[model samples]
Target: MKQNSLRATVRARLSGLHDAEARVAHVVLDQGAQLVHLSVSDVARLAGTSASTVVRSCRRLGFGGYQELKIAAAREAPPEPRDELDPLTATVRAAQEALGGLPATLSRTDLSSAAEALSGADRVLMAATGLSGAIAVDAAYRLRALGLPVDLPPDPLTAHLAAELLPQRSVCLAISHSGATRTTVETARRARAAGAKVVTITSYASSPLAEESTWVLLGGGQDLVFGMEAVASRLAHLTIVDTLSMILLGLGGGRSERAVSASAEVTADHSY
Candidate 1:
């Protein structure tokens, strides 16, 4: 089998690994580019672990051995010269880069399939937790304003009940950044089991939530800096939803055009 990118694969599996391996994994994930230049012993020492523990961590990450892990780490290391922008600007730039990265990640076939899914469904349900819940509400609002039947459940339990109540041809869009949100994943899984076609929006394609969905829309991973005001990942997700909404509206032809025009007219009267 072809070798996976160690950094990506291991990071995706971090939540499932044992504590020791997880600790080592977190260190590498948080500082892999810098850790690439260090030896196994050095890494173990820095992680406050042992050499044998490091080796085991590598194996747990699916590498044949420490040497192979090191090679993969080096390959994924950040380029020699880092961007010089401040953290907030850098975060924005990263989000823009991630947006550019989406075309290759999302194919024309995927977009068409998503559009078809939304257009053909009897109703649409959106559910998310935490910050992602806010995103779900935004998407639900836009779809509803476009005259598509949409429901945004206020909580996971309500979302689960709504999923169970969905008609046979309904569609559910589950938004989660990590794709490891237990409640959201379970809700999506149940939605799928109920004959609803599920679409997942997350950062990692290999995540459990992604595996359960019929279609997956991957966004950028979290923005580490920009302090508490950071919205890079959230913005990326909104962009994804915007793309989907536009595609669905386009498929609705003149009906959608007139609906949008009417909505704009209503909003125009309130503009200051």
Candidate 2:
């Protein structure tokens, strides 16, 4: 099976397992390649579980033993080939991997909730910082083109103000790959306090932004050679945004068709 599919399976099964098994599973899913070099006892110790439990967990996942499970996981894992590629190719590949990782990470429930929020909102506000700020603007523009009332805050202060001004029954959507952006988290908290529903698209569901959100969208992440390169996390976040846009379009029904047509007509006058 593809790595993405395997990841989905692991996530789906995670919560169903007992705590010890869950911890073991998390270690395997989160650090699969690293685990290949560790013995069963070492992995068990890392997960705070007994070695026998680790073996049982491996069996539950269809592996005959812990070693087999590690081998399978390593085979499905993405190659960290940064050193083998030129700068441009590595950068492009990282983005591509991130995009590829999106579908499995996102949940249908989250997408549906986001669509409902957008459809019911008086207005929608999106905010991000740095590279994510550009993505927020693009998402806002797309939603606007689809006839949704959307805004993108220009700065952290403006974002906070916008969050505070969110009326009851409105929606505020925050985008952050790290899920630790202080401004975004604070804005989301304020929006929620103001009685507007808040949605967060982020790489970590356990992140602070997720803690403040009514709806949480998941994305994927990959280690990168440099912090500046657009790696898997950014691409995953963009894909989540794109998926949310599509969901909103579907929710708008006939209005979406008209809005898209208008956008096409407006774009016809512009050239590269």
Candidate 3:
């Protein structure tokens, strides 16, 4: 099997693993067949846990031990000749699976609370860094097109300062795929300290950013592979942004539609 196929197999069983075991599974799955080369201790270190967690994850996956798991993974059939196309195929499949599973992961109450925070806020500050920074900018454009007051500075410090100075009844939408981006997490903390409602969109619900959020929107799926930044996590974050925008627009009713239409009309002047 191709590396992605191996990851798919492990991911399918992740739901059944205990939390620590699940983290181990994710680390293994993300590493794919490469996990076969790493000893249990290495995997434990990479997964931010102990060897016992790796062993438990192996058992949870129905293996006798980490070595057995590695051997089994090594024995799987190699990818077909068309494996060159697998990356694209795998990424699309991952994004679809992730988006399909999102509703079950995030409840209507969670979405509703997020929409309420954005809709009621006098100003909306978007904080993000790296790839997530692009997502924040895109989301801010979409929200501002509907006449919502949005601030999305390209500079991290500027964004952080915006979060710090956010007034009461303001909202800060922090986008961080890892949920561990120090700048984004710190901005979330400062936003809350200034009494602004914080909405966090992240890949994991248990991340530090989620803990700081007044409302948390978990991405639909976990990223199984590295080096593919736009595959699962980016799609998941964009999906959450679009979903929240729709929900906020729905709550705003006809007035919001008119705002969006008017914004489009103004921008149409630059079109060919």
Task: List candidate 2 stretches off by more than 4 Å.
Answer: 4-39, 45-81
Q: Please identify which of the two predictions, 1 or 2, would achieve the higher lDDT against the true structure.
A: 2
Q: Which lDDT tens digits does candidate 3 get at residues 1-272?
A: 22333344455456556778888987776565566679999989988899988898888765788987787667544433324557777677667656655654555798899898788789999989988888998899888876789998778788778887888999989998768888899888999999999998876656778779998786644454665644677887898889888888887777689888988888897788
Q: What is the C-alpha local distance difference test score of each model?
A: 0.74, 0.76, 0.76
Per-residue lDDT of model 1, residues 1-272, tens digit only: 11224444554456567777788887776665566578888878877889999899888767787787777666553632235777666666556545644553454676678778887888898868988888998988787767678888778888888988889898889898778799899888888889999988776666789888898886553345444222655776788889988898978777677778877888899999
Model 3 lDDT, residue 5, Cα: 37
RMSD of each: 5.6, 5.0, 7.3
Ordering by TM-score: 2, 3, 1
State the TM-score for model 3. 0.71
Look at candidate 3 and give me any clashing residue pairs: 1-77
Quote the positional error of residue 101 for candidate 1 in Å: 2.1
